[model samples]
Target: MAPPLMTVIGAGDIAAEIDRHRPELTEVVRAAYLVHDAGDSSNPHSSFLRFPHRDRSRIISLPAYLGGEFEVAGNKWIASFPDNTRRGLPRASATLILNDCATGYPFACLESSIVSATRTAASAVLGAQTLLGTRRARRVGIVGTGLIARHVWRFLRELGWEIGGFRLFDLDPAAADRFGAAIGSAAGAADAEIVVADRVEDAFTDCDLVLLTTVAGEPHVHDPCLLAHHPVVLHLSLRDLAPELILAAQNFTDDVDHAVRERTSLHLTEQRTGNRDFIDGTLGDLLRGRRRRDPGRPAVFSPFGLGVLDLAVGQWVHDRVVAAGRGHRESGFFTGAED
Candidate 1:
């Protein structure tokens, strides 16, 4: 006899599970330390499984260990392609697997697109809470309005900020509209006002908090002067800001090692300029009270999404599903080899 094969979840179920377990996930993210960087070339990429129905491309397997309250480990497999946008498909699709720590047995498999998005957003929210302090941010400027933007909006709403005064700008007009509508509807008690900006600069005007989520591949769109006057800026996408912007700001990353390994736009700028001292500290260090906030300089939070976040969130979702008897177990799925 062998251990039973567990049920596989789709994207919708995974998103719901993530929403349900978000609070616990937030605590896990706050405790995990950053992984060490091994250079850009050493960073892992995804593997592929093709299907004739979808004209298969690539699936990425990302794994990590988080040591803290949960004490668990897991990996996330993401299916992605730039072309998926044409068919109304997500550019990156993902699935997460959580394993039992003690025996290394398979625990549960769930959708990770939502888990990935929410964790990314929650990390930003956490950064804001730390860097921005209790100052009531009057305006929030968002540069991108894609999946990541959606969750960032959700988490910001949870933080009890006013959403009605949000300034949104995206390369796609329709995306900006969609994000505004969705955010406005979900925001409760907050006078949510969404404004569509004609240009990126228009979005940044007089905003106390700025979030850049573009895939522009370069930092030209983000003008340091625009943010110089702003209180706090969250550069969630690693490459969205220029090197000068990074050097000028009091930069902080979720993990110093992983930030460089991901070779995000920020990392590339640092390399191009031959300046590494621009990075002030890691988010983990700050959260652990090892690093202090600098009141004189503008704060920048750059998080190269971590695998540990997925593992912790995945474990939380799995436990909830199991408690509810939601996943079906397939017995004798894997047979042991004869000794």
Candidate 2:
């Protein structure tokens, strides 16, 4: 009605929409990856708008289109400022703009940071479960205890993955404490103890799953031997470990092109090896049985966090809310008259 009126979905509202469909989100992600693997989606390499002066801050634009039963198009504009954590602010925030493909008109705007983060967590956890062939991780170690880490914990728990022990490491010990408290309140069933590791290596020392979700520009974890335990690494931050570790692991990604372009560890690995043969296909490939994992080497999954995911999740949220008579609708968004 009335040009399908533009709707605004706030962050809280989006969260509510996601909460209502948490279980379905995983399946939605699976479908998105299946289409992506089948070459049915157009997920361009994300464009980064970095500041010369503000090296630690940048806004990324991920634009994509999904062509399948859930056909839709959208872009996610997300920004991350490392210093924001010092001021008690979220490091990353984003918005998704869903467009009408036929008319190329934006029909909805969604607070998309949640969608982005949740999709990422879902991907990481899904990989862990599928690759490990278990819903639970014996010990989960995280490099950064920020918003992403919290979301990952919640998702794992929701999937009924009993995290035997969680080791957290953040530059700010207070952040670690806070995270521990949050987990304690969320799911500390005696077996789920959150221990703040003073040293980053301690987090990696003995773990079944290791997650690197920090704000790093270049490689630091060099030894590569450090990951000798060969734990499944959910390389969410993209650029945390060194090329040697990347080369040492069986790599999987959401998109080969996008993940290899962002100066991530995999990018560095390509630079060091001078070839792309090391890349072991994508998460979609794994889920679709196109590839298999070898337990001999560490498994490192690096997802480029495609925009098609944002489009799918955003569309899902919009449809759910709208069907329930939600979302702030506004007509006459454009001032024009047809001749």
Candidate 3:
């Protein structure tokens, strides 16, 4: 009998590999959604650990088992502290632990902030492609200028989305300026106009595509008129829109049950409306043709950040790292096998 080897993958290795395969990761995310929709996965509701006095800080545990082609089980433990930005640290950090399904033994541990952001960005890009039914947009607007927003922009650029320009808005004016500068300096964006928006409404006006990645705890954008352009909105951060706006749009989510909890905008919508009828379908439904987009109304995709997605992407990264001989492998991680 032999003990199962455990590999530790760090952030640098993960980032390098993922940066090279951003487009491919979109397919990975799509496949994970299909598998989960087929009932081949178990994704429990995320459990949040909150500090007594720190209302804006939370550590969440997302546990999942993805069957079918990816026979792996894992959990992503991630923390979000809004105040970390003041200390010159990223607001979110994470770790992923992957277990072999057959043996139920932990086989890999990976630094997962990159993994988390990668999957999230991949999902957002995929959602945009599917709902918008196009690889190009005349103009794109981003509401938050943070790590996830940056990743989404990179995925869009790497995937070769043709955009005429980008309008960026953030609560912090400096963050918006920095994000606009990054876009201005990027490789494919030299021809694209970058503007730092003076108001949040400016991010939605006349843009065919909009991204909401803010850290807002509750709904603030109460005006449904901001969506007059009827753009495909990627509500990535999950808490930025008001109930009226959610009800006014054609809503799609990663998982209805998951999204309609945690006091998310959709959750608040459900509470106010006392029904789930406003939700059009899951992203899987859209992928499988069970649901179709209504071109007459605004399209909004809200994903609850599925745990199976993290597992699927993490497993892929682990396999790729091991195949490349990049991760550090420990031979005697589990000692009881020799006994």
Candidate 4:
């Protein structure tokens, strides 16, 4: 009998393939969300590995199994180091492993930094469209100019969103300027105005859509007045808004239990408010017409990065790479393991 084949997918290959299938990838994420909501998935609470000395550095393990169309199980091992950006590197790096459910053998190892960012960005954009009820925004605000932010913007543009202007805010003005320059040079945003906001609150002002992608380990955004325009906020970072702001908004998350842990902004809000009533419902509920967004307040969507999403996207990438005769396969990866 032959051993299970294991293929390794690199970042470049993953990026090219993902670029070719942006719209399909978004649908894949949306389907994963629906599968998870229908109780066809097992997504355990993510485990955090924090360093005692380096308080801001941590690695996370997300283990999950999706049972519907994608009958696969996997885990994403990801590291987040805020200081890495200071050394001119990305703040997050990740790898994904896919396991065959029947045999429980790992068949693929993927460079998943791009996978992580892509899934996160796709989920964010999906949440935005679900909550906003429209794809055209006269003005948009982005609160972090990092790699994840870049990917979210790319997804928004590539998915045929009509965004008029973008206001960017970053702790480092240079980073904001660089992101602005990149946006200016992108294919679809040629006519859009790019402005670097002087303050974080400025990112939320007068914009119909807002993306919060900061690396803040705690709440830094406290002003609810900044959200007076009732923007649809994609809180991808999860820990940026204060309890006051969360309480004041119409909240939606990928999962209630998942988002209400890990001391995220929702967790902090629960701690302060002494209940979970602040949460409106999951994005799935909204999509399924079980819940409706209140147009009276700012709608904030916080997704606690689900592992099933990683598996779904990773499996898609793996299958495509294999079909196209790309990626490196190790034939003897599982040879004579009983020895």
Candidate 5:
């Protein structure tokens, strides 16, 4: 006899399943912890696999332990290239492999590029709900017009937020127009309108929620003035916003310890200013109601994509497919029923 064979799915299938099962998937995220210092760094570092790339760069493996009704181990490989934009590609691309804890076998190997995008968006939405108080957010300002931005928009729409309109900006104005058109076409008035901006500052003005999902590695990309106006800012891409913006706010992270260890913009700021005190709370604290948001200070969320999220979502996909007899089962070893 042999351990069960895991089935792998592609990007499109995973994206569709993620859309259909977002709430359940997000619950998994809410339950998991962020793991940093996995011994690698492109952005959010984790330990698992580190493979070299075309230009002496490397793809780091991010693994996490997920416990509960769902028990499993998994890791996602993230490849980085600051020059990917030149080829019309994102700076990072990833793949996920879900493994069985009982047998230590690779059960499923799914294309996780889309998974990465959706989960990141889902986390941002969860963070907003936690920090901003769902009732308080009516409008959202999106600073990037890319894949991640599209996913975030859809997630917010699903939450039934009265999104008054969106302020869209991109290095490529044409890309911004294309994104606006797509959102307007699919969401109709639910998307309200897409307002294009000439600069990052123009986008943040008068918005209740601001989502920064750019590839910039510097802090000044997010002018203090821009963030000073927005009540809640979700730093989805880890370190896209300024340290000044972070220091000025009641900073909350998905995992404060992990954020610090990974040297995200939050960590860098702490190092530069010698002020680790800016960290106000973690998502777990807020979710568990152990901490409450202070209305006077601006709220910020910096979530480093956690492995538990991938495992949870992967488990969901795995179980559903397995129950339907959808994945291929190959023989290898069963050694014994009891060992």
Candidate 6:
């Protein structure tokens, strides 16, 4: 057989390439969730590696095999360092490796921060759309102004959400201010009023939608009644809200098993309750018409951010870039291979 093609895609190339392929990214993430919920995907719960000497820093590995329109396996190696931002660098960075299913040969190394952010943004938008139940989002709140938050807002706008106002709250007031300016300058956010809240509750109060993307190791938002009306909490930052809040909300997660890990907010809620009883069906169930949120209560969607999503998006990028002749190609990536 001829040597397998291996592609090395950089972050800049990945970003430019995905600009025209975002719709597919959204669809792939949506499909990954459905396939996963349908028991067609292998999503081993992500493994976290913490540094003994480092505070608020760790790396995560998410491995998955998606079975649907996508039938391949891969893993994402991603790291996060809150201190990186203070040093004027990105907080999170990643690389995605896509492998051939038949031969298990690694075929591509794609810059994955963009892919990770895009997949995550897709999940958040999908969850928000599902929870919205056909209503246009008039107001949205976000805690933590970071790359993930920026990507979520971008995807929301691209997905055609008519957000009238935005509230932002972050531990660093400067981050919030910088993000507020960026959000205001987004393609269609010119007319929307963006507020940088002095308190977390100020951001949470009276919002039709909310996203938590903080980098805290433990829960901070202690008040259960804060989300009393329960605007759909896109619990992007796994461990932010207290368990009592998760208990009172109509909880939905990509995978109940995975979400209840690493001492996430959902995990804490399950431990306190001693069961997964509070979880409403997942996004797949809602897509399958098997689940619905109780209108009387607020909704919380915690996606474990499946690895299959990265694989799907990465695989798509590889195929598209190869066809476009855009990324670097190496035919001898494996010296052990013989033609």
Model 5 RMSD to the real structure?
4.6
lDDT tens digits, residues 1-339, model 2?
246589999888888877736558878888888888888988878889999999899999999999886778888999999888779898888899998887777899999889898888878888887778788778889898887887887778777777788898998899889888887777444558678999888888789899888888898788887778888999999998898888888999888988998688889889888999989989988998999888888899998888888887888889988899988988877537462
TM-score of candidate 4 to 2 decimals: 0.98
After superposition, which runs of candidate 3 have C-alpha atoms over 4 Å from their true positions?
336-339
- Tens-digit lDDT string for candidate 1 (1-339): 246466666666666666645555666556544332211112233334666765535566777665545666678888767578888888887778776667666666777888788778888888887887762577889998988877876676655565337899998999899888887676382366679998988777877788888766456564678766745788887777777677778888866666864457667766887777778887767766778778777888888777776776676666766777676655554455353
Please provide, for model 6 over 1-339, each residue's C-alpha lDDT reduced to its tens digit, 9 standing for 90 to 100.
Answer: 655788899998888877756556788788888877788889897999999999689999998898878888989999998889878999898999888888888888988999999989888888888887853677899999888998887787777778889999998899899999988887888999899999998888889799999888899988878878768899998898898888879999888788888899988887898898888878889888899877778999988888988987888788888888888998877868555
Q: Report the error of model 4 at residue 75, Å.
A: 0.6
**lDDT (C-alpha) at residue 282 in model 4:** 97
The whole-model C-alpha lDDT of candidate 1 against the native structure comes to 0.71
* Cα misplacement distance, residue 275 of candidate 3 (Å): 0.4
Model 1 misplaced stretches (Cα beyond 4 Å): 1-7, 33-59, 187-190, 336-339
Clashing pairs in 3: none
Superposed by TM-score, candidate 2 places the C-alpha of residue 174 at a distance from the truth, in angstroms, of 0.9
Error of 6 at 264 (Å): 0.4
* Colliding residue pairs in candidate 6: none
Q: Model 4, range 1-339, lDDT digits (tens) per residue?
A: 576899999999999999957789999999999999999999999999999999999999999999899999999999999899879898889999999999899999999999999999999999988888878899999998989999998888888999899999999999999999999998888999889999998888889999999888899999888778888989999999999889888999999999998899999999998999999999899989999999888899999989999999999999999999999999999987994
Q: Residues 277-320, candidate 5, lDDT per residue (tens digit)?
A: 88888887787777898877778888867766666667777677
Worst 10 residues of 6 by lDDT: 17-26
